[model samples]
Target: MAETRVKSFVLRFLLAQPLTYWKLLKYIDVDIPTVQKTLKNLLRNKILEYKNNLFYLTSKGREEAKDLGISVFNSAMCPECHGKTVTLSPFKWLVKEFESLTFERPKAISEYDQGYVDSTDTVARVIFMYQLGDIEGKNIILLGDDDLTSLALLASGFPKQVTVLEIDQRILNFIEKKAALKGWNNLEVIRYDVREPLPDQFKGKYDVFLTDPVETIGGLRLFLSRCVEALKGEGSIGYFGLTHLEASRQKWWNIQKDILEMGFTITDIVRGFHTYLLERDDILNLELKVVKEAPVEIKIPEVDFYTSNLFRIYAVNSPQPLVRGKVDWQRELYYDQEAYVTCP
Candidate 1:
């Protein structure tokens, strides 16, 4: 059972050292209730004890884990990033490649268009896809590439073809220029909106699709539906980012249901995988407005704080096709008052 396996993993980690509930939630991608239930069960069985704001395995828990063997921790490893938010070894090459590329940073568009994560995270995203065997001669499409992930993917010299569909003309043009300069002939860009049905020629043409979608139910559904339309049948994989800061558990459940109903099975979720920088021009000013009381001068954030967990879903059956035609980009798809706050 998934629940049993999760509890065992937590026990194994406790064998090494006590962990706070917050760290467990932030690093482990399992549902909150599931984690809580597992902790409760372990406590009830006298296999775990809590003290000093940490959870530790009791003597019985240690004995049970010994019976299970130390190797059990292996299964607990995050399938997406391969380790628990641990940066990959040999990652410097990816970082170097990312740093070499240059582009102008655009102002965040009133919470309608979320800003991209730093280049390192963009490169890391591509690397994770590659590590999962989703690259090399596969047709990959980015439903949205505000992060310029396509560049990193192409720079890695994997994937037979890479396509980017973006609504922002500025991003489209920038990608086009950089691609040409790099002589990435296999890379292509088109000005397209996710609210619109996927172009006929693009449908059922990709082995993988990647995006960081708007978190609302309608928004996530529309974006994911378009990506599913563009994927080749079973075994096709899609990757995207979702965050707890914006999406509640109920919203996640609805989105997961939509994915399964459309014929996908979520394979892996790496929590806090993508980190976004909060530059003054990007999000610092916007975030300051949302607080109840505004300070005269807000100091810049030292750390890159905003983050989203990565989800990898595989097409378990033929992708359900939606009617092919233009669909209006309703305000509900991009703007939900509950999900966003912007200064007038």
Candidate 2:
């Protein structure tokens, strides 16, 4: 997909500039024959029309670009975080627009946009409910107002009644106006601090509940436990955590463990970043950065069963030798174990 995009970009420019053989071949990373082959393919497919030595994108190609362009969205430089890159999904776009439209005035939301708090991903909000299958007419609650996850659900023509429980009235008022403007019959906004136990009226009445708690705080357990408390026997709860450089996958597992212990089934999984649509390639094995700083005389630490109750690797220079001449610890200790997985 990326290659095709790069080729499309190069073609658009070449068509505009009518790059000479030398310049076309010299300026772009792709070779002359390769660029010519792409140009020929585009000409054959009627995506680009060649007349004389000049090439131009055809009406069909222009139309297609326009259609694809509908999915593109822009942000105002993220005024706070200064993170420039953003994902290109339309659903993700609407979630962002919906949230900004819904919470443009709150002090907390202002803080969030300023990066005083953390930014949340809208795609993740939808996906959590989406991965669980249908929610039409299902009772739902969202603790935070980032992108109005529940509001998006209402607009999707599903979720019978969405009860958004938020602390900020300015945010709530914004959502209420949005619901009224859209004529959404099933959406409701409530003012409540989710940190407290769920109100008596909400207990066992919800079908789906989720939280994107105050970022970086340890309030996840409390919020999740409240969601669990408000859920019916078969209800589901989803929550998100902000994991920066301090945590690893093992720590995420610990988070999952804690959630499971709170009495909700922890089966489905989703991962995302604030502004960027994350990919597997983003995870770098940064162990070398730490290892490069240690003293020369220092020895790699051994796995202490209790102390290293997380992922473990025995020191290569341990005091004791293996029981036999050698032992395959990788296979014996954690083959196929997810907790100890290396990057693929």
TM-score result, candidate 2: 0.47
Q: How many clashes in each structure?
A: 0, 1
Highest-scoring model, TM-score = 1
- The prediction achieving the highest lDDT against the true structure is 1
Q: Tell me the tens digit of each residue's lDDT in model 2 across 195-248.
A: 454677876776666665432213444555555665665434444443322233
Off by over 4 Å in 1: 1-87, 103-111, 281-290, 293-302, 321-324, 341-344
Residue-level lDDT of model 1, residues 1-344, one tens digit each, is 64676676786677778776545544454544455566667878888887766777888888888887753343455665544354655677867866677456454455555567877778778777877899888999998887888888888888899999998888888888888988889988999977677888898999999988887778888888888899999999999998764565667889889889889999998877787654445444665332222111223443454568899999999987433456676667765543532232
CA lDDT of each prediction against the hidden true structure: 0.73, 0.46
What's the lDDT for residue 250 in model 2?
Answer: 48
Instruction: Write down the worst ten-residue block by lDDT for model 2.
Output: 304-313
What TM-score, over all chains together, does every model reach? 0.71, 0.47
Question: Could you tell me which residue pairs clash in candidate 1?
Answer: none
